[model samples]
Target: MVVIKNKCISVSYSDPNFVIVVVAAAAVLLSLCVVPVSAAAAKQELKLRFGRNGEFKILQVADMHYANGKTTPCKDVLPSQVHGCSDLNTTAFLHRIISAEKPHLIVFTGDNIVGLDATDAAKSLNAAFAPATASNIPWVAVLGNHDQESTLSREGIMKHIATLKNSLSQVNPLGAHAIDGFGNYDLEIGGVKGTRFENKSVLNLYFLDSGDYSTVPSIPGYGWIKPSQQFWFERSSAKHRREYMSKPEAQKGPAPGLAYFHIPLPEFASFESTNFTGVRQEGISSASVNSGFFTTLVAAGDVKAVFTGHDHINDFCGELTGIQLCYAGGFGYHAYGKAGWKRRARVVEATLEKTEKGSWGAVKSIKTWKRLDDGHLTAVDGQVLWSKKSSGNRRKKQIPIT
Candidate 1:
């Protein structure tokens, strides 16, 4: 079976010498076999390097609706909707995980910079991508509602993405890019192909740009993709499946095609059915809005997974349009990581697993840590959020960031 994924956070095990122990959820036997692929912590020696052969270690990176025009580290800053996030020191918080996982690639699910009302703040948000981009590591990003400067009455947010895109093009053409500034992008991790980027041969991971202030766009609302994009997405998705996954008849996969987007499509938001199977009429800005976009995605969803964020609390799960719709916790959003879950931010470490039948799936887990005064991840709080249940495929726990 062939496995496909673009941005994956995971632990590597090249050896069998290890131990097994579950954290808090032992009933599920969260503790199982363990191994080490690369043991030392991940760090950047001025310049970053990846594991040879497209192989690398896993690091958890979460959202940081950070205040200030900085990627400075944020530790339990609490959920403050009061604005003025651009001035906060977030470098220490960001470096906490950056220095630890030494991730060759950084996966960001969006919502970090909160440029409430100032153009300078928006510009700062745009420039903030600098420090991370400076690391010379690859990154996969999608915008969240906070990235939506539309309602904030600030055009700076959009301008920031544009500026950041231009700056990245000059330094590392492949490093920075916007999926047409619609909150979509794709990058290769461990050689696995995934994303909504323009690439066709890359296993068809189609991400959407559902605009709005984070929530699924409220139909005729501002900032959301127009109804026209759905057709564009449908055509694109169908074409990708036929082009990549040869066996589209059974919807089985040796070649998997997936989709990701920032906001959740309405069909996937159903709590009662959890069916995640439905088309959207598009209405009401206060509640959740559904869209046919996900249906268009899942028509090919059987061989793929639709991943997203916003409404980040413990994480929402459902299946729609034949795809596994996953709502992983946000990287830095204040409200998503459960009320009491400690640690300031988090990163998703997803492992692409292939079944004996040539089917594809991913085992996702979260890793969290705190930013110390010196600017680095404190190993104390980092913990695994999910692991492969394939019996022997447990992920290796993260090393202490001390």
Candidate 2:
């Protein structure tokens, strides 16, 4: 007989069930041991909130194009530096920028690896994102055209990214929405802690997978954001808006939103050199078919800016109908770039409004600037994308590129 006393399993010498009870008790103990490990993982989830100084900074690193670790040769680098330049140069730049800016969030806005050159997609992705992971900062990513030319499909790539340390990138949003793309998700930045609006989502970030090649024979360029993806976005945006407005302690209007994707929309071609801040060296490489994603954004009336990457050399920010469209210049040495032009990344800073009682409130202004990978890590073309004080008039704060 097996006797249970004070949570102890006492087995008799003659009992045939002794071994079975012992095995069952071992299984129960093993399951109890697993609970703390699962709880630890749950506790590791990142929560983004404003600092005491009321600022949240985001660093946009785009088109890394990393491949095969240190073996891949760099393109379009100066002749003097070409002897040893490789993907490691890109990694070094990431480390340098992260050190200099110390951003709250790092966004890898796609083409993270050149899939064709990557013999092992997982290894390349690990090296490509090592900086963000090592820094212990929250990071997220979208996908680009060339990311699935290797061992993994687009869905596989997103799933791999979602497993990396400090990665906030999701395979897709949960629920029965049936979104069209892989990395279609959003992250909310909460207000200052200990404030009345601490739990409130003050800033919203939308990430979409602007897909690879066109499926339709007639529409020739890159793939556009699908209708279902747009529908998901609209629903998500509306939900955020409703939550913000319903709160008693919420500020006057809807919280500002920013979007990140891999490919530029067709509307990017509409900006002239005179209207935008940075240089557009290449043609707008948007999909042939205008998928009306820009129209969806404008209609939503919450997203203040959209950041994209596919055109490596075009690092410009232009406004159309109250929405700013911007590009994060190519950040990797493995990707094609101008020999003389320095690789760059974009930095966005959102400042919270100060209440009458001197505490932080909703987002007051959204500003952006570009940082070149030169020796100085030069900051250029600082501009205000949006401002509550301006009353819809976005003022340009230009810092000339030296």
Candidate 3:
């Protein structure tokens, strides 16, 4: 800490016992140098903290509510007419997130199109993905309750996903993947340099689909993850973490691997949506609450942070057990929204950066961007909340209290 007042400038350091004052008549600055840890210390805990320098970027966009099949002769697409967001003013914002962030992976966390309308969620998804396609960035997407429960059928859903993939082909030859079973998909990111260290590293990302299971299948109103998919999800999620370990490039971290999903997990779910990890979280999910299915997945080892969207409200990121749950504020249908001078009802631009060494860091950022309002690509006010990393904290902590 530094203080300058009546007659002095003081400098203080938070070491075992250290508070020193350095006076500078000509203006002097003190820099705190964090000593690098020894290799042995590094091995004990992997240090992963938020840093500007990183190898790749993973951008998550939620609830675009594109009016796919409907024709909006004028401007607004009424929710009463389609019960979905109009994607108004969001296209440019989406493009801006891509253009400025240049993320390596993009995850659309469901509610992609206002599925209630005749407009195909697939076409709306295409429009939403236009910027990603243009940037040649790879992406993996999952569906929301609105997507599964909408007028579209199972076949319709499959067709919609396929349609989006087809359109993406024009941009990326590797194309897109719809994440089999539990909306669970994996990708690897490498070539990141450690901020403090000299070695380059990589990151493995997974999108866990804790599909909406609130509504009963018999009711025929919402998307359910289904038992079979839940079964496969458990088996496969574990498989991914094990597979991640084999990768020589995978950063040193927890084995569960990093994942993003729509809808909150059992532990994070509210009472009404609570199921521990069993049928509630897994029903269309798996009965995930206190059940074995949810336990087994978190136990996989490499699981670091789980970013999600479904609350359709604020951009929240909190720690659940060892895993971090990040909610990218509502990106669609802010019907009762007002931009608080800062535009609180806006989109969130999140990033997971890996330092020179193999440490992982997460950042929650807000942007009051208006290409039509303002032209620069900078994030609003230029401030963010970043996670702190120890000397070698690789986020390798095992999960599940049981």
Candidate 4:
């Protein structure tokens, strides 16, 4: 018999013992899994808000490339540390960063697992995300080129991810939008309590699936963000703008937006050494065909920055046409990295502005920096991405390169 679902096909032979062994393994795994949260419970718990100190911190974990749990060997590491290095080292780094940063939300910007190396996609995903699930912090993820090379399809991986504890990821948006890919959704961050904009969405977070390899023979590179996804994004952006404008504080202007995806866009190649901050050791591995998504982002007039994680070693943030494009650097020991360079993650903090009466108002500025997985968990390459005070000047600020 042949069975197919989520783009995965399996052929079953007539064997009673086969079913028994599969059932037994599933039972054991299910017993260990955390109970999935109810939709209403998840909605309430995931509603983001700035702290009393008027700050919302986000930790961006990129290219985890985890596989086979603790068994996967470390890549591109020093000889001294190569003895016992494995995927467990990646887990330890995640735990250390989460504990140190204590971010309100964690964003896994793809390559979460090395599907080819992972013996079981489901098991690998569970192990890869155990730190976030165990930490009980709200998190979201998008797909990468490597995540669907296992038994599970891209759709299957996203569906499983949505069911994980404290996960805000969705398979797709609700309604009949006919989106191009799975895991295209937006999250709103509400304003501070007791403020006039309290009920208003002060920030928007957009997630899109920049797909795997190119399907067309003529296009000999990565897949571009489809036109359908662009249309959906435009509609969503307009809807959020209308809602924000309904209130009197619309004069404060539209809420800032930040987008996350797995692959970098073609526009990433436009920056040179003198133009961008941080290091670009490798070439930009972008789609061969330009999809005009960057132009759409500029047209939307709200997205302040875009974050991606395909070219692991190129950890830079550059401004182009009023939007900041950034790479989160490599975070997993299993993924490719420099020999002596420590693994790192990016931290983004958005602070609310102070009102005339000395209370928190809308978001004043968005700043970001990276933390290395060294002894002190050192922070480096700090810079402001966007600020309402400098809204008029869209030129790139000259930050010293690290």
What lDDT score belongs to each candidate, Candidate 1 first?
0.39, 0.83, 0.41, 0.81
Give the per-residue lDDT digits (tens) of candidate 4, residues 10-73.
Answer: 1111232233435433433333222334453345345677778888889999999999966789
Q: lDDT score, residue 182, model 1?
A: 50
> Model 1: which ten-residue window has the lowest total lDDT?
168-177
lDDT by residue (182-212, candidate 1, tens digit) is 5343222222333221122333334445555
lDDT for each residue of candidate 2 in 1-402, tens digit (9 for 90 to 100): 000001111111112222343443343333221112233234224688888899999999999999987789999988998998999999999999999899999999999999999998999999999999999988989999988888999999999998899888877655323446688878888889988778888899999999998876655778888755666677678878888888577556789999999999999999888998789999999988777789999999899999999999999998898899999899999999999999999999999989899999899999999999998899988989989876345555655543
Q: Which scores better on lDDT, 3 or 4? A: 4
Write one digit per residue (lDDT tens) for candidate 3, span 68-92.
Answer: 4224321233434344334545665
Output the better candidate (3/4) by TM-score.
4
Global lDDT for candidate 4? 0.81
Once fitted onto the true fold, the runs of candidate 4 whose alpha carbons sit more than 4 angstroms away are 1-45, 392-402
Per-candidate TM-score against the hidden true structure: 0.53, 0.87, 0.56, 0.87
By TM-score, the best candidate is 2
TM-score of candidate 3 on Cα atoms, chains taken together: 0.56
**Candidate 2 local distance difference test against the native:** 0.83
Off by over 4 Å in 3: 1-54, 68-86, 149-151, 162-182, 190-201, 213-234, 237-256, 269-294, 333-402
Worst 10 residues of 3 by lDDT: 1-10
